[model samples]
Target chain A: MKKSLLFLVVTVFILSMVLSACGSGNTNGSNEGKANETATNQPNADKPKDKVTINLVAFAQPHEQKMYTQLIKKYQEKYPHVKVNYITTPPADYATKLQAMIAGGQTPDVFYASPENVSFMVDTDQLLDLTPYIEKSDIFNVDNVWQKGISKYTRDGKTYALPKDVGPFAYVYNKSLFEKAGIPTPDPKKPLTWDEYISIAKKLTLDDKGNNPESPDFNPKKIKQYGAGFWWHEPAVWGNGADYINEDGTKVTIDDPKFIESLQFVADLRNKHHVVPSSEDESSMGGYTRWLNGTVAMFPMGPWDTAAFWDLKFDYDLMPWPSNNGTWGTWLGSQGFGVSAKTKNPQEAFDLAAFLSVDPDIQREAMTMGLQVPNLIDMAKNDYLNMTDKKPVSKQVFLDVIETNGHDWAFEKTYDREWYDLFNSSVTQVWDGKKTPEAFVKELQPKMQELVDKSIEKKKKAQAQK
Target chain B: MQLTEKKKEMWIAYLFILPLLLQFALFTVGPMIFSGIMSFTDWNIVQKASFVGFDNYKNLFQDEKFWKSLYNTVYYMIGIPVGLILAMLLAIGLNRPIKGSKAFRVIFYMPAVCSLAAVAILWQWLLNKDYGLINYALSWFGIEGPSWLGNETWIKAGLIIMMVWKGVGASSIFYLAGLQNVPKSLYEAAEIDGAGKFGMFRHITFPLLTPMTFFLVITGLIGGFQLFVEVVIMASNGGDGPNNSAVTLVVYMFQKAFNYYEMGYASAMAWVLGIIMFIITFIQFKFQDKWVHE
Candidate 1:
């Protein structure tokens, strides 16, 4: 018993010693608080500016964070007078920690701000007015950004933030598959009219033709080959110009005539049209694998899906999202460089933001990953598409989607969160087939209006106190 | 007789455990006081917590999610107690003076040290619908297995099975310790009297192990209520666990505080859970007064 107790004591001692070493090894090892006196002194005679550090917090994945870190390091190298204090937060708990940082009076010098909480920052005047910064750096094209994203960020005609990706849905077909189906290529120039697209889908939908459309024996039900396969929701719903949230980023638009119509169209492709597979079928075969397995001829997705498709080793052709309202629309998402108003040096902060956002190399690397749409026009055409890098993805989709059918997607309004969740929750009712589209929309309208009014009053009171 | 001044001073000195008192005040007492205060207010990381008074507590009472989580906890309480009783029975059986009985003890204790997290995950794999050990074994019996974790009705059963497997060894150890204290003299006395093996066990050995049984039940209930790791990892994103059939209250509190940033609501939840746990332990103690041999 005594020997066992002694062994346990040594074990605990070793465990705690290792834990404490890991505990303090983080911030101190990063040399975060150290002053680079040698480098600061070398340029002292010519430039007497004191070196300053800027804290930046982000909720990006490791690879995405690595890109951001590389940008910061390059910026520090160029502008020796500046140092970057970068903190990579896990995507899950970023908002909680960020809020704590804000309440403590010292937020990151440059950090990611969300559309949902931008109003919170604006309410407290804790965000920098980027108007002047944008004017100074013409390379940061403010006008050419997707209109819908700008609509959400722009409160009372002042933009707050931009995104790295806007979820724009497109029909990616196997050019080889289309050729095998004997469906001549879709007009690359025009994409397709809604009628033309669906008719083509119906025609190319069968390996075991019951007859022909002309022969009155066309059977869509028991087709051996599919004309197109949709991954149920998301791009399909949003592709039809139906949004989850309104343009203001506040209200959910689930019951919108257009939105319900979109769901009906996809559901009809299964139930009514007998074209797309049922939810049960898709549940068994995962979306990525379904297309990769050559079971589906045409797959539907957003520009963000390019990396997944590239990794799957499929020969594919791209088409712009099918049009509904005479003209096609692409919902755009993009990321922006935001300078915290709490920065001790706002001008220096803006200068660093410019250096990071406007740098050709930084924009090039981001564009190569197909992770972000570069805010700059010139640097947007990056060259990492043709690399022998570990996993190289084509940047052409990012460029082409923007060049052809991309449109600014209006973000839903950001106001009362629960009220919005309730509206989004109501979609599950329609999805579960309990409520009709018209009734669901009508039933929830009053709830939405009441919450919107409450939000408006809350914002009014908050502003008045400020 | 009146106590001498030196005698009183020495006795008082014995009561003053300075280092322990200081440690208690700093870590335990300090946190308890702060948590009590926090329970009454909205202490979100953003913006000064405008004191919402009892609003958070009031909302928690009416929330459907809170009630569901409570139901889940009750399910586990019923489950673990029943399983622990079986473990005690097994330990008693294995404690017999038979060949290779020592080997059985080592085998029983092996699971006690195995990480519960790894066990939870491994059991989830075993209970998986398409490609699991349990279902695969069931296939040999020509039996079709249900989606254990995916289905709400089956999730509680799956969690119970995992808990029992992970927990059996620990309870067995406690039973073994209690069984050792059951004197051989009592058994010898019963044998001389022509009382059978069953007679001795029923009257004495079982009664004597009541102290250990009570301890296990109390600690097991407390530990079961704090179930989060398995629910979070195995269940869908939020431990809502498909139809929220497996959402324990503590998991709900974590979701509210961390996921949604409703700290005021979370604090109220934490206090409510603490009160529930206290009441449960109090009831167990009250019952133990009647039944515990020690």
Candidate 2:
């Protein structure tokens, strides 16, 4: 009886200890809340510029990492008093890792922000408002940078980040493949219509028996080469004068007939036309390698692919994406740097962000490395267009899309992208010939709309909490 | 009381275990209680939490994705039984006094020790629809192998195959040890009672191995329920698979908590999973007496 009593007492004591531990956790959470209140109350705690070490976090490829290392050396040379620490992780883990850091209260002073997460960051107060900083700084000119890049991270007249690079997509065709097929190369300035594009693709696609998809004896099972590889459906939808959302962002318009038509056309290329590779075939030899080996005649190119494409064995050049409505559309992507709202050394962090973002010398070096199209409009039009030492001789195609028709990706407007992700996963059925594009879009509209509505509601709640 | 020798020894034993007790109370018990409380509130880690009171749980019931994930998780448990049977057969086979049996054991055990990420990648190549070795072999029999990873209907089965292949080695080792524990006298007695090899295995060997089988089943079910890394590495798009067919409960919970920051909902999911696991294990333990021999 005494031993059991002792055990009960010990159990009670341990239970009390557990309760106290939870109580301490609550206290710690409230303490973090207090810290955030103070951080915002004193937005700029610019202590005497005595050697402050501010850290920046991003994800980059090896070459991009080397580029940043060189850029940091130059920046430190210019401002020797401020020390910058750059942290990089693999690209796939960057977003999750950055958010985890913020949650852990180890938020980096400066970090890369993509369009997809900028809204979420803003809703969470993770980003510092850059409008005041931009107005005070003379070196970082908003007028010089492309509006397409700058506008993505701006919300409610407040700029949260500055554009580091603006990636414009261009249609690149293998010149050797065209020559071997005894076909004339496409004009750089003009885009082919959907009908013309399909006919040309049929001619370019070849079987082991040397018959094109257009021939009676053509065998898709033994196809030696594919004509085109188009992974993204957004471009085709936009080119056909339809969009994922309406202009006011009040409604999802993906169920529009134009969107279904465009989707069907892309799907039919693989399922019906036998020009584009099927999902199974694409997996066997990835689209990137297929393009590299000259098995695929045409594929989309981004500014980021420039450096890698330079070493291709066969000749290649850029053309406009095929248009259904006399205007081509593709995504213009941007990655930017933002100062953390909780950062103590706001001034130094902002300076580092600006130097990395809009500095002419840095942008020029990045352009030389084929890392990006210049964030500066004038430089992209003149300097980037004149760099004829690259394989993609028609550089104007990239500029034309950035300057004219490229739209921000669909998910950029929302705080979260569950809606877009759901749509992408579900739409595979349409692409695989299991369902018609029209039926799939009709069935998916309400579901996608519901998720979008939920995200918007979440954003409103976040704003109200703030 | 202090003068009592037994009481003094008990106090010393308590003192020795005090550090471990404190650690458990502080970390494990504390966090579990906190998450239980958190499940009742709406908390985005960065934002202030507000009490929602079972709203998250109610939402979970209506969520199609939750149901899909749960179904997928239970579907993956099919590998456990399949793995156990294969492992038992392998253990029995390797128990023979044959040339290179030890080498064969090592060869089979290789997959269990290999890194999951590397193994998943190798399986991806082997399961590829067009150029895979599996499909190439099927072609010899004039049969076309279905797209294993690509089609929604086949993806779960594909994952089950990979999981079974990876798990059989470790399970067989446990069964092998259990087989050694079975007295050779029992088999000899069965044989003397006019039993053939199959009869001896059925009556003596299989019945004797029930305890090990029970232990393996419980652990395997628990492990199978938490399937995440293999699915993440194997599935093409961040573990969603074709039409989210490969998304298990734990993966969905992870996506909710980390990717979407729905901590309260994810906490509710974790609790539901915990409850399910507890119920299953409790039932298994309660029924073990029916099949398990002393």
Candidate 3:
């Protein structure tokens, strides 16, 4: 009797375990159904009654979190019903983790979105379309947002995220280094041409002997610090107008003469002119350290360096990159917000996205906190350029671009990775003097064509489905 | 006839084994099969996987960067074995009934317990070209040091050197234990036969240490391939810096799946690596019988 009773209990326990395994899946399905039903029927629900938990993902880690949390706190205060939980990820693993979350249908209501991300999710029907929510919002400026960020974020006339910052280029110079070298600073009145800039770099070049400029017998080998940095970088390619992809986002122009010339120009600063360290030196000590230590005199960087230099206690001035070929150019980058399509409340998610981006206070706060250049054009012109309390470098870069010619930053989700890799590889050979510009271009054409062909086919398929 | 005593015994054995079998299937076997399947598809986090067949494998054939990674792994594998041998020799030297042998063993074994990840950070600075300990020493020799990890030619060698310094001690301890296991009678018998030191090592000590050598070699090879943490902490950048010299296959797999979000491609690369490893191990076992005695 005891053995029989024990067997019954054991069998029942095993049965329950098996049933529980199956039961969880059904429970999730029913829970999703209940949520969807609640969302559909809850138009008249009071503000504080429907508590929403939005996941906020950012590419920038602990650094961005410090400032972004303050922004989130302010938002929570405004809408007491909404609570945002910020999930910070390392820049290296951001895309992979975000992808997993989307696939698992544990998608964040709002996440760090740009043309580089979220679009792939959107195409896969994993991101919610924000068009209706964006239109409904009173504070959202549709035209200004589109004019600023549409190039990078739009797919078949639908905008995914609003612009967050201007990641445009600037030429930052050391006032102390120039003064110490007893060399005249480059003219702030007129943008230095390539020839003039080289002359300035030469003048600023000094041996440890206090011999300012080369005395014609200057020992390049014994030089204390090179006058300029000639590191292999992306801005050099952009300055010379090397387009990685065409308007259709399905072509490569890396081997173009202008691009090849730009790489050669930088490489020559080390190899030929001896004004900079060799490729080995460039590799060993990256440009940022050299620039910081005053070893490299005038360097090219983005507006983000303004905050970096501001805290360094060194006298510095930021200038727009000089015309390498009579074109005033800088690379602009746009970052914005994205919504998950897999969310039970697409409308609610879209509402959160609009509030995060379309809020002018949030945009200005992001700019002040050094997150990015303000996305609003009028605001950038009036407020960002004319802020008296902060440093003037931010104003100068934007004002120069606005007055000269507007450059919008780009972000492509799928196509840029292959194209960027091709450009970097092809130009590296030319920079090393292993391959001629003509050969490099010719070699790249077929490979670029194949990748672009694939991209276009994918885009066309996406268009047809839409 | 339907259920004999032996059959019933086997069934009872299976009943006892079922929990472990289920756990293994759930954790190990399931993931292994899924990973192999993932290798054949194109997966990112957001999208459903699509079958890419052999495109990833084909691309790896053309990837110069992948080849560089293979070079780095191979370089590490080559160095670790030679280093372990030298360390074993060092172990043999310390095993003598000389003064302070205990102290020497502990001193050498200290690095075995020291964190490779922690030491690599300091080693990175010491190996720095412009302001590093190695260059300062090289200056005395009238030889200017090349940028160790920053130079393409020296980067793999640099990583190999770092790994060897950290790993050799643990192998030395294993050899020391093996040395302990060598029966005293064998050495005494050699001495009675008037066999000198060289012959004593060759005939008795060396031949007897083969099993320990085999164990260390296997562990060394496997450990060498999966080395990622020290390299990551040392380089301070992804695998692309310094002419892609520091790139390794595991690092490549990691970046492809996690960084680039090409999980399917990474999974494909991972499976090919697994197959290569399995073949190499099988060959090692097949050929090992000739040299290794029961």
What ranking of all candidate models by DockQ puts the best one first? 2, 3, 1
Candidate closer to the true structure by DockQ (higher is better), 1 or 2: 2
Compute the lDDT of residue B254 as modeled in candidate 2.
Answer: 84
Runs in model 2 deviating more than 4 A are: A1-48, B1-27
Q: Give lDDT per model, in order.
A: 0.65, 0.86, 0.68
- Provide the TM-score of chain A alone for each candidate, in the order shown: 0.74, 0.89, 0.81
For candidate 1, the TM-score is 0.75
Q: How would you encode candidate 3's per-residue C-alpha lDDT over A252-272 as one tens digit per residue?
A: 666577776776777666656
- Report the lDDT tens digits of candidate 1 across residue range A2-57: 44555575566556655655566554434443444454445666675877777777
**Taking the tens digit of each residue's C-alpha lDDT, what string does model 3 give over B172-224?**
88888989999999889989999999999888778788888887877777777
TM-score each candidate. Answer: 0.75, 0.91, 0.85
RMSD of each: 7.2, 4.7, 4.7
Top model number, lDDT: 2
Candidate 3: stretches off by over 4 Å: A1-49, A142-146, A180-184, A187-190, A211-213, A230-233, A358-371, A392-394, A399-416, A425-466, B1-24, B43-45, B50-68, B93-120, B227-237, B258-262
Off by over 4 Å in 1: A1-46, A103-106, A124-126, A138-152, A162-232, A236-286, A289-308, A319-337, A379-412, A416-466, B1-32, B76-78, B89-124, B188-206, B243-246
DockQ of each: 0.16, 0.41, 0.32
**TM-score of chain B for predicted candidate 3:** 0.87
CAPRI grade of model 2: acceptable
lDDT of 2 by residue, A348-410 (tens): 789889988988887898889888889888888889888888758998888887888789888
Best by DockQ: 2
